[model samples]
Target: MSNEHTTITESLAKVATRANELCNTVDAQIDNIKNTLKAEQDALQAKKTQFDAQAASSISQYQGKMDDFIESGDNRYQKALSKGDVIVPVNLKHLDDSKFYPVTLYHCKMLDVRVERYVHDDVSGGGILDYFVQLQNWSNGGDFTFAKQFHHSYSGRAFVGKISAASTPYTSSIWLRGGWSYKFYLNGHYSKGPVVIESETQVVERIASTDYFLAPITEVQPHVAANNFILGV
Candidate 1:
């Protein structure tokens, strides 16, 4: 009887050891699965963040282009100037038969005139210059009224502005698009219009009357000095 009992106790001990070993194996497997699921969740979150950033950048670019389009279309002038949205003055001059020969010049920052992109050039001494419109030599009866609006580029943005005829009842309407100044000539006259300056750069001598070269009779001296500093039209 003692031998039989001892044998039964040994058998029970073996069964209990096997059951504990099986439980330990199951616990290890459960821990591994939890770790794998956590890793996968972290990876998915990273991918989502990357996709969101790319989507935001794309939206910003599209919105920027749309803003440029709408800005170019806004016109201060009542009349449409040209078939082209913005006018670039190549070598514009007037005909002999016209009452007043109209010549329009777009004083640009040079790099701003690209059709695909408006590039700004900050090269030293590479500044504003007169760009006169040149009519097609063959299109004789064509009028100068088309090349009216001028577009300017600054701070990597394209801005549309206008220079209209002062002959009408209008008050020589002008638009300032974050620039130091703009120069124009009407019927062989220079400095007849006002020189707009950023209020900060404006000096009392800039708009005062002076006998400087290219200074208009009606222009204040302070503006003439400003034109001199910027080099006149």
Candidate 2:
């Protein structure tokens, strides 16, 4: 009986030792699985950060390129057309004097408008104009009378030999240079008549430019108004 009890006790001790080893193995495997999951999570975070940085860089570059393209277009336009021209017949309509006239240039906002002149001449009914290279109105004066106004000193009185035009609805061109010299053309014909701007002083004093090249002219723009002024092109 003692011998049998010793053998059984020995067998029971070995079984317990095997069970402990299996539990230890299971615990180690669980720890390894947690470490592997942590590593994958860390890798994913790192990759996400890298992707975000790359996307931001690409967006910045695209914006920069767009800005450069717009600037380049402006430069090209300025170089091509030293003299500004607008087709008046394409852009005008007659309106009553009591109503306000509006002119838009280069898509810039005016926000507000104030009149500069209100001359009740026979033709334009009453002419209106703003000071400062923004357009004014004098369309009613017709061709001959309106042309006279361009060179006049704007003193509310008539002056002598006021740089007049031969006809109405004539095409006028101004060099619109830094010095403000202007040249005139009639109709579509570029080569027909003498380019009568009269004097450089007359051109510079009356015709002008803003900080920007193009100016605005309203529908009430005079047939007598310089051709460039008529179109505001």
Highest TM-score among the candidates is held by which one?
Answer: 1
Candidate 1, run of 10 with poorest lDDT = 108-117
Question: What is residue 164's positional error in candidate 2, in angstroms?
Answer: 37
**Each prediction's TM-score against the native?**
0.33, 0.31
Model 2 lDDT at residue 75:
70
Per-residue lDDT tens digits of candidate 2, residues 1-233?
A: 99999999999999999999999999999999999999999999999999999999999999988888887887754333232352121112233222222222111111111112335433343343322222221232242321222221232321111122222122222211111111221222222222223222322112235121222222332333332242333
Candidate 1, residue 11: lDDT: 96
Candidates' RMSD to native: 17.9, 17.0
- Which residue window of length 10 is worst by lDDT in model 2? 106-115
- Judged by whole-model lDDT over C-alpha atoms, candidate 2 comes out at 0.34
lDDT tens readout by residue for model 1, 27-116: 999999999999999999999999999999999999988887677654522123322444332221121211111122222111111111
lDDT of 2 at 142: 41
Supply the TM-score for candidate 2.
0.31
